[model samples]
Target: MTRMRADLLLLLAAFIWGTAFIAQKYANDSMGPLSFVGARFLLSWIALAPLALYERGKAGCASLGKSDLGLAALIGFCLFAGAGLQQIGLVTTTATNGGFLTALYVILVPLIVWAITGARPRRIVLLAGVVSIFGAWLLAENGHLQKWTSGDALILIADIAWAAAISLVPIFLARCDRPYFLAFAQYGVVAFLGLVGGLGLESFSGEGLAAALPAILYAGLFSGGIAYTLQIVAQKYTPAAEAALIMSLESVFAALSGALLLSERLTPLALLGCGLILAGAILVEAEPALRSARMVVRRRRR
Candidate 1:
């Protein structure tokens, strides 16, 4: 695919993920957090099975190597943990708070990448991180610094987990031959974990299942299946930094959707926060200005 097409797909994935916050909010109203996550992934795994079969043929059923399996399982655990925490947080937090907190993963990813690879982050990235955090604070605290809540704390932790999972992807994908297989494996592991947790704590009821069914289908098919596939494909064509920047738009999209669909009002402070978040994202991702400055410096040196 063209770079532009890949970029668009990644953006679409962000949009789908953003809108999913609302669906999840509705689903949580009627189901236990573990139960909801388990059901979503279970349905997602089943939905993606045919695609996996097509990619690997009948041999797709074969088990992964020990190392590959372990890595995949680890990734699955991270996924499960992050989503599980976010789901639990949603029980107490507003959807707006959840969205902003989750977007912190974007800022965290660069810092984690720097730590793991021993690479220094650019000035723009540092500025972006500061701006994004300020935006998050504004959105979550409504311009107050002293009003943070427990749900916000949980979501922040989940964001760290998400950043770790995302950073680990390039490493594993570089080493593994079958990205699709690895993806499916992670889904299976998470689904199992979700189901196990759900069984122990949740009271299953027909009405509850019915209420969460739409969210399950939406998250499974669009967010889980299509969005994930797009990420894999787009990451292949785009730089990790660029992909991360595009995906960070999830926060902006989520806030907009919340205001539009859920009648969540966007106060002036919230709008300013969104602008700061966008400014941070641009600072982190844009390279043209840096290149121009470099060219001017080289000309002056000559």
Candidate 2:
């Protein structure tokens, strides 16, 4: 597929993921957080089985070494932990707060990369981080940090975990070529871990299972399967900085979907937070545009 097509697919994938927060909320109502996550991952794993087989047939899955498996498992665990924590946080947090807090991962990614590899972010990224921090404060506390709730705090923690996961992806992907297989393995590990946690804490019920199945299926197929695959493809062609900017649209889409579908109202402060997040995203992605502009200027000067 062309780069343009891949980029468009990634944006659509972000929209699907943004709206998935609502579906996750609904599913959580019927099942425990871990249980709901387990169910969704189970379905996702099943759906990915065929794709994994196809990828493996061409590349030989056995070629993946011990280190690759270990890295994949770690990524899967991080994914599960982040999702599971976010689900727990949502039980007490407003959807708006959850959406805004989750987007903090974008800011955290650069910081995490800097810490891990000693690579400094560009000026725009630093500026965006400052803006995103301000936005997060507004969204979580309306500018009053003392007003923050436990749920909001939990979501913030999940945001950190997600940032780590995002930073780790480049490292893992560098070691492996089969994105589909890696994706499948990641979800499969999460499914297993989620089920173990769910069974340990809560008993499963048929009625609850039936009630949450639709939401779980939607999250698994669209959010987990297609959206994740698109992200992988898009990341391959798009620079990480640009991809992060596009993915930041998740917050905007989530807010709009929640307003339209759930009848959720955004407070003025929350809207301001959203705007700040958009500004931050633009700042984070500014390097590419600046470079392009500089190239054009040089050609014109010639």
Candidate 3:
């Protein structure tokens, strides 16, 4: 694909994922969070199964090795935890809040790396973390600590889980070359765990399932499968830095969708908080490029 086409594809993917936050919220109107997660991931797995088989056939592998399987399982567990918490958070919080708060995961990544490796984050990363956290407090508190809801707490935990999951990706990818099979394994594990959680914690009704079917299919097929496929293809053409910038627009789309489609409104303070969060995330993404540009300018002066 040309760079233009790839960029468009990524933009589309971001739109899909952004709208998916609303789909998740709508799904919660009828069924439990775990059930929604279970059904959607199972559907996503089924949709991707054919592609996984095709890729494996090309590689001439009948099954993944045990190490790959174990790694996928661990990654899947992290995915499940993050997704489950986000879904539950959507139950009480507006899609707007969920979107912006979840974006905090970008800020959390460096902090997570620091915690895991005992390496100190740079000044920019630390500043971003402080800014993002203050933004979150503003968004979640809405003027009073008493107004803070369970959903805010759940989403915060989900953000941490997402950060950890993303940090694990490089390690996992280094160990396993088959991205498609690894995705299949991850989805399968998430489906299995979600199903178990749903069965143990929530009751399923056919009527409720029917009501949630559209949301589930949209999230699973379009958001999970198609958007992810587009991202994989687009990343081949686009630079990682540019792609990250484009994908970060997902938060903006989510907030817009929430406002336009769901009539969700944020107070002025909350809007300011959202803006700060977006600024912090953008700084995190742009800092490396800025530093590199500065170094080149210094060399030119010399």
Candidate 4:
């Protein structure tokens, strides 16, 4: 695909993922968090099976070892936690809040890397983190950091889990060289855990599941299969930095979709907070490009 077409595909993917927040919230109206997670991922597993299987015979696909499987399982658990908590949070939080909060994961990943590896993050990364926190504080009810609602707190915690999952997936893929299969395994792990959690902690009813079917299918099939496929394909042609910047628009789309479709309105302060958080994420993804351009300018001057 042409670069422009690839970027548009990515934009479409972001739109789909952003709007799926509505479906997730709707699912919670009838089903519990874990139940919805289980049902959603179960469908995701099925929808993705063919693609994952196709990758199984690809050249880079490697036989997984016990340690690799263990790592994949851990990543799956992290994903499960992230997705489940986000769903639970959506039950009480507006989709706009959930989307902005979830976007914090991009900034959080650098902090997570620093924590694990003791490598100092660039000043830009630190600034981005601070900006995101300030934005989150603004985004909170009453514009106070301490005044975060329970749902907001859950969404923040989910971002931590998402950061962990994001950081570890590269390691897993490096070792296994099976991106789709790892995804397959991770989805299965999430599905299994969600099912177990739903059975143990939440009441399950067929009527509830039936009521949630549209949400489940939209979140699982469209968000999972179509959007994900678009992302994978688009990334092949787009620069990584450009891809990251574009994908970050997912939060913006989420907020707009929530406001337009769900009648969720944010205060001016909250909107400012969303802008700061988005700016922080954009900075995180754009810094390398900025630095590169600066270096080129310096060389030209010399």
The candidate scoring highest on lDDT is 2
**Which pairs, if any, clash in model 1?**
none
User: After superposition, which runs of candidate 2 have C-alpha atoms over 4 Å from their true positions?
Assistant: 1-7, 59-62, 133-149, 239-242, 267-270, 299-302
Model 2 over residues 1-302: C-alpha lDDT tens digits?
Answer: 66567668768987998889789988878888888888888888889899888988984455788998898888788889888899888888876567667777777777777887787777677677677667755664465543447888888888787777667777776777777877898889889988899989977898998999889989999998888777776666664544665677777677768779879787899779778867876664566668889999999999
Regarding lDDT, does 1 or 4 come out ahead?
A: 1
lDDT of 1 by residue, 1-302 (tens): 77667778888998999888788888887888888888888777777787777767655345457877777788788889888889888888766567667877877777887887777766666667778778766765475544457877888898887777776676666666465766677678778998899889888888998988999999888888788767766766665555676787777788889889979888888888878877876674466557878999999999
**TM-score of model 4 (CA atoms):** 0.80
Q: All models: lDDT? A: 0.76, 0.77, 0.73, 0.74
By TM-score, how accurate is candidate 2? 0.87
Clashes of 2: 0
Q: TM-score of every model?
A: 0.86, 0.87, 0.77, 0.80
After TM-score superposition, what is the CA distance of residue 31 in candidate 3 from its true location, in Å?
1.4
Per-residue lDDT over 1-302 for candidate 3, one digit per residue giving the tens place of the 0 to 100 score: 58778778877988898889778888998899999899998998898899888887785554557876776788788889999999988888754466557766766666666676676667776676667556655654352444447897898899787777655555555565566666676678878988899989998999999999999999989886777556655656654334544565576567667778878787788677667656765665577668889999999999
Off by over 4 Å in 3: 1-14, 59-64, 92-104, 117-119, 135-146, 149-152, 227-250, 266-271, 294-302
State residue 54's C-alpha deviation in candidate 3, in Å.
Answer: 3.1
Candidate achieving the largest TM-score: 2
lDDT per residue (tens digit) for residues 1-302 in model 4:
68678778877988898888778877887888998888878888888899888887778568889999899889889989999898888777764466557766766676676676666667776676677666655665435443347899899999889778756665675576666666677778888999899989998899998999999999888886677556655655654334544565666677668779878787898788778867865776577667889999999999
Query: Candidate 4 has which clashing residue pairs, if any?
Result: none
Error of 3 at 160 (Å): 2.9
Cα lDDT, model 4, residue 45 = 81
